[model samples]
Target: MGVSALAEGGSGTSYPSHREPDGSIGIKLLEASSNRKNDPRAYLYIVDHINPGTRVSRRFEIRNTSSSSQRIKLYPGAAEIRHNTFVPAADRHANELGSWISIDRPELIAPPNSRIQLNAKISIPKSASEGERYGAIWAEVASPSVKPGSAGNIQMINRVGIRVYLDIGPGGDPPSDFRIEQLTPGRTEVGMPVVKATVNNTGERALDLGGQMWLSDGPGGLNAGPFRAQVGTTLAPGYSAPVMVMLDDRLPDGPWQVKLMLESGRVHHTVTGTLTFPEKPATWGLPALLDSFPLWALVIVGSLAAVAVAFFLVLAVRRLRRRRRVAQ
Candidate 1:
């Protein structure tokens, strides 16, 4: 069903608005509490609307209607709608809920005729595209008195969701985005480290790239670049460029953090990687050389060395016997 129909109280839409075949219906947006005295109602709150990031916090409320207490389970679910149909007006789909939004604490117990509130926070990706997204928050009732899982139980699952309409605008210069991929020791010595960063144009527009790498108090703690990148400058959407940062070998060895910074448009994004340096090489010289080779090669070389030693011992014994025979 179209998002607009679900929001405006239209009938015969594919999306169900309250009243499931099993007799469960979503809580209406403006419905009063069934437990008049206890305030058994549900509401939704959003922290931000424009930037389309996930770290938004959603809060819900439940009230106990019975004389004793009630236990409630809040299920966090999510569903995605296409970006095209999202409209900011009230006429858009308001109740087309997504899966239950995930909550840190899933269950709660309310005291006799008491009210309870629950909150869930989700991490939104910065790369979320601009568009209309729809999903629901489900509050399921689990009190034993409600026939515990019965369809007609006073314990009910209420659903509410927001229609997120994000518009970042079309056709602007793309933003430069960068992330650190790997960092490690480049040579066997205690120093000399190699760091790698992947820079990309995550936005819809092309980006002019300025990037740098710096070591924070560790192996080869040196700063590389604000390099003028040639490949990353005109990156199309989702294209990436790999840049390597090299540090001098004489730098001290220890735990180190590497940072990569990229500038595009008016913003800069920094990505980081962590690495540790060992006090010494695990092995050295011939023993280390053999250890570094493949197991089969090491076995063959060791076998040849054993044969050569046996042959030399046999020849020395024969020569000593011949000398003794001449003396006799």
Candidate 2:
């Protein structure tokens, strides 16, 4: 089903927005939210090699574009790098690092065209050991409820966050690194081909692992997929996990070569290997004439060829005799 919207005064119509007069709300990490285009860490705060027992602060801005007022909620949650993605913990407080973050203003009301600046303090404990921790400060806006008698009274909310990374200790540098132990090519439960990379965290710090992948099928090096490595695949020191990239589309069934490039902060690594598909090439019920066969099949075809040759020779001899009789 489709729906339409009209202007309040029946003057003109356009798509709907949560706010009246199509107003909007914006959240930015200082100047802007992460465009995620050129700068991967544009909206993220990176406190590199900062010693424990120290304090730091992070600030952000939220603006209301609508004519009416809006209430914005803020909170902090633990985050991890896994499966080539940035994954955050649930609303519940879980990560020990997240406990160090203190949000002074949890809620604020912003008038139309107003920008509100908020601050959060990171108070690291003196006993904090050396390693890296992941977390995020999130801002959210929720839509109002539906009318009294509607099909569903569900409300929609949109949220965005700024990622935070802290390195703790006196000489706090946990060998910012990890390694790709192996690349195994196989299929998923649904029979889709996937290249699974086994990775190990060799450093003392937890690493958020993710990367890009490229695949070439067959001898011509025909490119298939540039699948990305799993993001937010977090691994503590002496830990391991499987980072998988699924070939979700249809491609020629053959041997393929996969190249992967992985990175965490300043650390980056690239690896390449071969993979074979589990499924065979599609055949439209055609006979297995070109397919590999047993010796019995070969012998049967040879026998049929010899029988046809003998029958043709006998017919030629009979025709020659008939011609001789007519001439006599």
Candidate 3:
């Protein structure tokens, strides 16, 4: 990005044109030579183009024809170039200045009668919303550093604005919308369980609901269903549909987890419920006989009776031994 003065053979020095960090042509500043009584003028060559969502590095060359070293300051601002009337699509007004899509450093220094080049690199954000963005890069020559009485007052303030047009395409698919709730068991004898799930349309667009569920041993457990629910052709905004899930009574007696899965095209979501069965007491054929024997108390009585029988046997054996001794 090199800009030339193209002076019309004037008496005083003229400033060079402004160029974007990229090689594109920008604004031009025309400064009258002190000896010549011509007024300074500014000109710009606006460049417009589309930038794909990618990192861009640009280099700009500024040439100084003055006798003293000059200081330049570059800044980023809204695009002021008039080459084309470009407005971002309505969905793209959220981008802020100096975001990932902004210029690197915006300042530079140039020596006398020589050219200075500056490089700028910008990275587009990955999370940036999908839409078109419009902006520009602005460069202005700050107060020039000069010696006393150097070619009249440095009267040239060069400004160049470059228009940036960017288009960010659509991102990955929207997130899945599914939730599980209201899980309960049917009856203790049957050991049946029922679960309810609500699937809602949380995305901006309509989604098709189709998938299955099954009981699993773990959170990632078994396929509960391949149960189909005709949630209708479309789920309007903020609308939800109810799905009832039932477990077979024949399912073994133990802790069980029910899983309900919902799928829309390639997207899949799952919800789970856990259930436990309580132990039941044994029963006899006769209702009265069931409580007739206090089993725990009877066990204690039997243990005491066995202890008494052993004690009596020991006493009888001792008496027999004494009688046998007396007879001897």
Candidate 4:
């Protein structure tokens, strides 16, 4: 896991680009468990493991980035990992996890360019199931009332939130792990090269996937990127999904060495191989010659074989000299 500064309303940066023009609001996690201090996800979300019948509290901060004051509403909303995505339910739809959460300040008037801190308390029942749940702590702002019959007078609402991934169990926390199953090279409809790595969650907990890919040993020795893996892919326990990396469109197809690194929290995995993007635009290519065999592994095997052959040849020459000497 890596640590990053909490973004104002988005991922990684203090000021996000998608701020609403009228009045933008931001929310971020303010506290993380000491055990997970090094995990970046803990600073961006409410990620924790709690025992049954235990009570826990987490603090979060909200910001008003607009010139005028804004009224913000805070609550817990349902979320689920569907199709490898963390999907929050529509309009504050409630779930078991959301029901268990209680915010100390549900509504507040945030002064212009000011920040407010709030506390959320979660109480797990003794009979709670031994599994993980997903939800979000949301801060929302709605447009002020528009005059009747005004042009395009539709009121809009914008909300930003911190995700919550909570696991309820007894005793020790469940282990988190995953593996890269396969890699496929393809192109999007617009001819941009893409590599999709199939990943499987092979442990008892969910994973929020992130990583990077580097290309080398290309045609004419022309090396390419350390392109970033696309984010927002979450995998539930025992499920599989694709983590995609989109490469530069102008990159040439070649027998390029690919090094991919993927991680979630503290767990990390690296995979290396050779790949050539599909020549046909928008199509996925067949597996390359060394798709399954890594270049490093191949080099090591070849070096060992060469050493063995050289030793055998030396022995053969010595034996022939001994036979000739005996004949003489």
Best model per lDDT: 4
1-328: candidate 2 lDDT, tens digit per residue: 2111111100011111112224766655552222222333333343345577877666776668878898877877787665444567654376766688877798888898887888877788888886677777767677776887788877777665666666677863556567776676665666666666777777776655667777775647688666766544656677888876766646655566667777654567777666566553221111112223434457889999999999999999999999999999
| Candidate 1, 1-328: lDDT as tens digits | 1121112111111112232223222222322222222211121112123343434454545555556654555553333332212123332234322221356667776576555666655554566565423444444553245456777756323433332212232333233344323334333443444444445545643333444555565545554333322222333445665444555555555455555565543346665555544446431111111112434456889999999999999999999999999999
Cα error of candidate 3 at position 90, Å? 19
Ranking by TM-score: 4, 2, 3, 1
* Clashing pairs in model 4, backbone N/Cα/C closer than 3 A: none
Which has the higher lDDT value, candidate number 2 or candidate number 4? 4
Worst 10 residues of 4 by lDDT: 1-10
Question: Comparing 2 and 3 by TM-score, which wins?
Answer: 2
What pairs collide in candidate 3?
12-33, 13-33, 212-225, 212-226, 213-224, 213-225, 214-223, 214-224, 214-225, 216-222
Candidate 1: how large is its RMSD? 24.3
lDDT tens digits by residue: candidate 3, 159-187: 54433433454543234353332333333
Segments in model 1 whose C-alpha atoms lie over 4 Å from true places:
1-54, 78-101, 142-328
What global local distance difference test value does model 4 have? Answer: 0.80
Better of 1 and 4 by TM-score: 4
Error of 1 at 314 (Å): 99
Q: C-alpha displacement of 238 in model 4, angstroms? A: 1.4
